[model samples]
Target: MSRDIHKKPFDEGTKAKLAIFRDYLREWLPVFIAKREIYWNTINIYDFFSGPGSDGFGNKGTPLIILEELNPHFDNIISKKLNVNLYLNEYDQSKYEALKKNVSPEKGDVRPYSIQIENLDFKISFKSKFPEMGNKGNANLLFLDQTGVKHINEEIFSKIINLKQTDFLFFISSSTIKRFAEHPSISRYIKLNSEDIEKTPYHKIHRLVLEYYKSLIPQNKEYYLASFSLKKNAGLYGLIFGSGHVLGIEKFLTTCWGIDKERGEANFDIDEDKIQKGQFDLFTNEVPKPKKVDLFEKELKEGILNKSLPSDKAIYLFTITNGFLPSHARKIIAQLIKENKIQKSSFNLSTKVCKSGALVTQVKPL
Candidate 1:
């Protein structure tokens, strides 16, 4: 990819989201590769709406960022001779050419990476190649980083979710959906019913869409989801992450909360906080207090009232369900133990090495 193409300039919010994407892959790929080492020989990555290598201002786009993120592990991967497949798609001809040039290894670049660039419409291309993309014994990560919600319909989402060992990250413009809620075209894309469109509050549309998407997934298949709303002030977009494992949701939420700890938009009750912390003056001396934690504790108590889970499973449940971190779960459980409200098999279990199933039961108030 020539760095000279006039590319689109990413705003501060877009940059933050891109950084989150990179960080997620950085945390996930290594762990995923290790876990799949026993069963798979290849790791396949797909970016359906990959843009040119750089923006008009010459800033690296998602494709280049993905390449950069993967380059560091070449030495380790090459030693094992593990096949790493990269499939990037760009509908624009100029961007397609640039993406090919950018991902092609330059001189002295010793990375043994298999890269394929497609210049066709992503929806059509993905549909035609869906079966080949999801080969058994190979793990896949699809990045449907489209410009908007035009192509991400139910068909694409269901196919990806149903595919064996495949996970996905995509962007959704909740603000746009809310703004155009009444429009028939927008309602069709978001799958909003007439009743929902008429009766549902605008603020609740995003949550409804999320729940609807989750409901579409088959019940037998387990998926852990995490989402982050970006630039609430600007009302741009939010990211939705769906993974086949609990660890994936944990890592994604960890990154999202780490980035926006003050509000915890991805996992916490940010709407209430935003309403309460509405429009503070810069000159004002008052500082908004942190949001309360009692809600999370209550959630934990209910989930663990009378449960026997591998300690890891308990942590995963609370984390994904209530956006509590493992540390927070441990703290809440410790408090319950202290109050004699709950009983645990042992107190020595740590989050990372908690392999044994821990039996926990709530004590009845006599």
Candidate 2:
């Protein structure tokens, strides 16, 4: 049996992971709430592995954090008469009872939104709730905080890929996959090469797992996936966020970059960038730079000069897809303009700009 995490006070790593979930929800709720009449009229949120509402020290878990975030939106939800549903499920019987007691409408004051607390296994819960998620008028957010990496197999992920207006956040014990790469049970779920898993650095096992999932995306599809690695003690766990729309990716990336400005991918310095020495340019002195940002900037500059990124819209997509914010891409564009490599153009890289048909000028090379 898997160990229970809520028996103890939530650790820093778990807190960090929950923080991302909370922050993303803060950004996520308003979009659908504001658009209740205009776009999606209903919002569905699922926490598949919700624990008892809090840890031993009473630090709020995902269920409580979610309610706290949604509390502020109750007025808007009430005014618009929007249909918002929250599904919180815990597989463990003990945890489920605790979840019910803690998350009861009377206790949490979550009466404004329709909420359901279940004690089903993830697979069963997902199967039952999936059809509701497929509704065209509903916006869905699914959080799978599984104890291990087995629940989100290819079969499950394939179904998620086909859903229209859904975004998902998945947690996995990536280090477990590395440690048990060759195990028969593990291989059955994720078909990664044992040799390759062994060769990957310990800290990057989570990223490797994410890459495996990325490979599962269909070539013709335009899905976006990003990862945030959490280092807990000696093990590495991570969260993978997925969405079909650029706006969803934009929100997630914003939350991630806010947490880890250096890499926008982890709680710690995953790249050991802080210790690395900056190469001195004989002509000009420069401060040490972050490795990931430097690499992304170099690629962004090359893509523009090569015409691979030919317009603001294309650059905007490139920026988010490469796990960056528009501001980062704009910084590169600013330098390019100063160097006379590209002609001046409207640097408005917002999705609204794309929809408004304003980003028409092709990036002219000088």
The candidate that achieves the highest TM-score relative to the unseen native structure: 2
Score candidate 2 by lDDT.
0.88
Model 1: residue 148 alpha-carbon error in angstroms: 1.7
lDDT of 1 by residue, 238-353 (tens): 78888876667777777876787654454335456653445554686565544535566665677566544434455456556555567667786677777786654453323344
Where model 1 places Cα greater than 4 Å from the true spot, the runs are: 1-8, 34-37, 194-205, 232-234, 266-269, 272-293, 302-315, 344-366
Task: List the candidates' TM-scores in order.
Answer: 0.82, 0.94
Model 1 poorest ten-residue lDDT run = 357-366
Candidate 2 lDDT, 1-366, residue by residue in tens: 245678788889999999999999999998888654448788899999999889959699999999899988888898888889999999889989988988887645546788899999898999999888998888899999999889999999989988988999999999889888888788999999888898998898888998899999999998999999998767799999999888998999999999997778999888887634556545656655678888999998999999998888888888898889988988899999999999998767866655654645579879
* Sliding window of 10 residues with minimal summed lDDT for model 2: 275-284
Each prediction's whole-model lDDT (CA): 0.69, 0.88
- Residue 42 lDDT (model 2): 84
Best by lDDT: 2
Candidate 1 total steric clashes: 6
